[model samples]
Target chain A: MGQKLTPGDSRSNLYNPQLGMTLIVKTVTRWVKGFIFLFGVYIVLYGHLTPGGGFAGGVIIAGAFILLTLAFGKEAALERMSKTVASEFDSLGALMFLMLAWLGLYFGGPFFVNFIQRNLPGKRFHLFSAGNIPLCNIAIGIKVGTSLFMVFIILSVLRVVVKKGERRMVQMKRRGE
Target chain B: MVTLLTVLLFFMVVGAIIAVETKDLLSSIICVGAVGFGVSIAFLFLRAPDIAITQVVVEVLVLVILIRATISRDVTAISGDREFFSMTVSIALLLVIFIFGLEVFKSFPQFREPVFTTMSDASTNTYIQRGLIQTGAANLVTSIILDYRAYDTLGEATVLFTAILGALAILRAKARKRTTDSSEGNSDQ
Candidate 1:
């Protein structure tokens, strides 16, 4: 992430109020972001009933956040979900999925035994159906969504180290350096 | 359907070739994006809406990241020293890989036929045939991934975590550490 400031611009664009894209993009983002998020949630929740599962839904969810960041800059996006929080959620999702497997094992079955379906199978094609599949999907969705968003943020924001009266990033050495 | 798929794949290949030949990095990225969207549409035509949705979203995010990367950076390709030789070698390698891939696919079951149903075990067939009844899930794909073969999904999640860990390790290097030490990590705030 190279930060390009114009010739007369002193303050970095990161701190600028007009940091992001043009007015049309921002306004359209404001209108469409909620729908994108809702669509993502719908895909995640109905994953058992539909063609999409956790991975696709999670990517859609991350796209909503990425849209916000692209339209209104990183600040607005970070205000909604910060990098640290996203990282925490990422781990939490993976842990939740692992916990589901462990629970199945503890309940007198092998790992990931679909314990709910074994006991009381819900009605087919219903929202509360699919035993533990929906829960697993939700966990995967959260994990993937946060992980991808964090990757985008990490890649987009460059660390500018102030060193020796110079304001520039210390470029990491390439291979064979 | 086969003809449609062939046409789609042909366009995708052309887009890829244009992407490689284009000097402008932005247009090249967009052309690559076109190739990806073509694959997504092809996935839909193949009746894999799951994959198509994922492909489109992933493609959009990749384009976003790529454009962001090039926005403040150089947008033109700086011709390297060994371009022609590398291109020849890569094309040769791709042909070799394609032949090997065809061999691998020849050993697999035919398309649109569930391979598990052909096995000897009756109980396995029961699970495969009556998965909707057993799992109470409408979508067989979801049941197959999250119920029957959950360990695979778990492994995939772990792989994703490991990839993110590697990315963070490389991206957050000495520059971030020194800045955080000096600024008490309040720079983001």
Candidate 2:
């Protein structure tokens, strides 16, 4: 639990729980998380042209959040992305991907067809050349990233319960009463 | 190249053995990660960059999740008859698999030869020739996954979605159980 704030006391650091690792870890994580997130976006956006795609990029993005949780504690990470928001993002990503596929059915011939005009004023190896592939990658990236982070957060928040006898024995030893 | 592959394979096998035999959970996880990385390197050497990338990222996520889930658990070493039996069974299975794989490999073409040498008009040739023109993507792998075999990719996405939903439901149910247990304890008091 975090420290409580009095009426006149500063509100800063009052809500962040004591759950993270050491100071060095927090500092390193702070510096690295942004770069990792940016790298993930890069992977997602350039999925068609690059080696990685949505799933790999999404996992990298989730890795950034996991690093934050590991170094700065679950509370700090959750403050940045709560359970509700993560779930919503997960759902939205999935829906967006599905809708893209549906667009093929509605506008184009078959399911998951390359509906959009693929040649969009870009060179062969340039970005924005792939039609619906990039869009799909972005949607899958968001969905996978949020879902994975949600799993990590939920798993980390689980409390380990000690047996009643063990708890009582520890308390009695400490109190000697 | 063959020697390099042999060395990498040797390292992968060693890592796998250490992963299985290590008593410390964290060390075991690291060993498994090493094995995964070795596999990724093999993929890269084989010119499968896309698979290598996916493998590496998946390995990282798996390691992170496993460590988080097992951090608080007991790391007791498994010993005794059951462990011995399992080990024996696994060794036997591995030997059988090795023999069977060698037999299967004998039926296939030589490793160094081009795989498409059997047919002049094979689908692989067609894929390489027209993959970029039809799909308009520079990366052949992307075009194959997203356009050529889109139905398979759709199936994969569906499977991923289903897995996430299942995980969420299971975690939520566990939380509900904990809450009900706490409420019952309070009412009893």
lDDT, candidates in the order shown: 0.84, 0.78
Q: For candidate 1, what is the TM-score?
A: 0.82
Model 2 C-alpha lDDT per residue in residues A1-177, reported as the tens digit of each score: 323334353334323345456667767787898999999999989988878888788989998898887776666677788889998998898788788889888884788877774434345677867688888889888988998898887776754433455555576578655
| Top-lDDT candidate index | 1
- Tens digits of per-residue lDDT for model 1 on A1-177? 233545464434434555787777877887999999999999999999988889999999999998988876776688789888999999999999999999998888999999988888888888998789999999999999999999998877653433332111222223225
Compared with the true structure, what per-residue lDDT tens digits does model 2 show for residues B88-186? Answer: 999899999999999998988888787777778877787799877666677787777777787777677678778877876787786777766976764
Q: Each model's TM-score, in the order given?
A: 0.82, 0.84
Write one digit per residue (lDDT tens) for candidate 1, span B34-132: 999999999999888999999999999989888876754522464444578897999899999999999999999887666766766755676657888
Scored on chain A only, each candidate's TM-score is: 0.81, 0.81
Give the lDDT of residue B7 in candidate 2: 100
Weakest 10 consecutive residues, lDDT, candidate 1 chain A? Answer: A164-173
lDDT of 2: 0.78
- Return the DockQ of model 2: 0.40
